[model samples]
Target: MNRYAVIDIGGKQLRVEPGRFYDVRHFTSLQEISRSDVNIKVSINRVLLICHGSEISIGQPWLNDAVVKGRLLHPCFGKKIVIQKIHSKKKKRRSFGYREQLTRFVVDSICLNGRDLKDS
Candidate 1:
């Protein structure tokens, strides 16, 4: 049996599992923290939903007692995407590109109510 959880961070909902890494939007609160290979973890209280094998719990916006724990792995920028803007018959055009700042995290555990599922 496998367990999974849906967590909300930076205005997005992400499906996460234990022992896996995910690239997400950078959090301003964590940016100032010195990067090190330590236990720099965060407990997110905004869990949207949780599923433990056969049992499932869905929250009304967010679960009050549910929490998702994660560790900061790294901070990086996503691949640059080019944007081209042109005006019809105006001969005015602009080309630019930008990369999104992102953060990587490794899910540590998912606690439902008061119990935590074992991290694999």
Candidate 2:
């Protein structure tokens, strides 16, 4: 049976599974932790839904009893996005590009109602 959960981070929703790494927008809580070279366990409590085999649980907004634990891997930058503005008659053009700061998070376990589901 596969176990997974949907979590909210930085106002964005992400589907996560145990033992997998995901790149998400960097948050204030992880800023200080990422500066060091140690593996820090991070817990996220904004779980919206969880699925375990045939049993599924959904929350009204969020589940107060559910939590997802993960490790802070590193901080990195996302793909660069370019923006441009041009005026043909005025012969003016402007262009710029930037990358979003992101962090790497690896899900270690998902806990619900005091029961923990760990990665295989």
Candidate 3:
């Protein structure tokens, strides 16, 4: 079976796998860095995908130096949830809806070839 690293983002846990797309929660502007910067930067460790059976121990947001290579497919939005509130006598009605923005990414692989993923 194919396995990929799962990460926690936007208060949600995501499992990333090859040739698969996932809808992860929106990240802050600081986390939206270029691929090049993400490769070199270590402090910006919030989400990472590491291979299984690897000698790696990842902390919250940091995957012990593991890295997940993925491709951006597109931004997609889920169905909007409708909310309605009404008062019988006051004749006041409120309607609202909300939908979250998500980023679609296809996980390529989790590896430590370029970077050390564990305390090896």
State each model's CA lDDT, in order: 0.83, 0.87, 0.58
lDDT of 2 at 110: 95
Higher-scoring candidate on TM-score, 1 or 2:
2
Q: How many collisions between residues are there in candidate 2?
A: 0
| Model 3: per-residue Cα lDDT over 27-59, one tens digit each | 554445443442221212455555555444455
Cα deviation of 55, candidate 2, in Å? 0.8
Q: Candidate 1 — which residues are off by over 4 angstroms?
A: 31-39
Candidate 2 residue-wise lDDT, 1-120, digit = tens: 789999999889999999899999956575454466656789999999999987899999999899999988888789999999999999999999999988888999999998897544
The Cα error of candidate 3 at residue 2, in Å, is 4.0
Evaluated with TM-score, which candidate comes out highest? 2
Give the alpha carbon lDDT tens digit for every residue of 48-80 in model 1.
Answer: 999888879999988889998888876767999
TM-scores, all candidates, are 0.87, 0.91, 0.61
lDDT of 1 at 30: 71
Alpha-carbon shift of residue 110 in model 1 (angstroms): 0.7
The local lDDT score (0 to 100) that residue 86 gets in candidate 2 is: 98
lDDT of 1: 0.83
Q: Regarding TM-score, does 2 or 3 come out ahead? A: 2
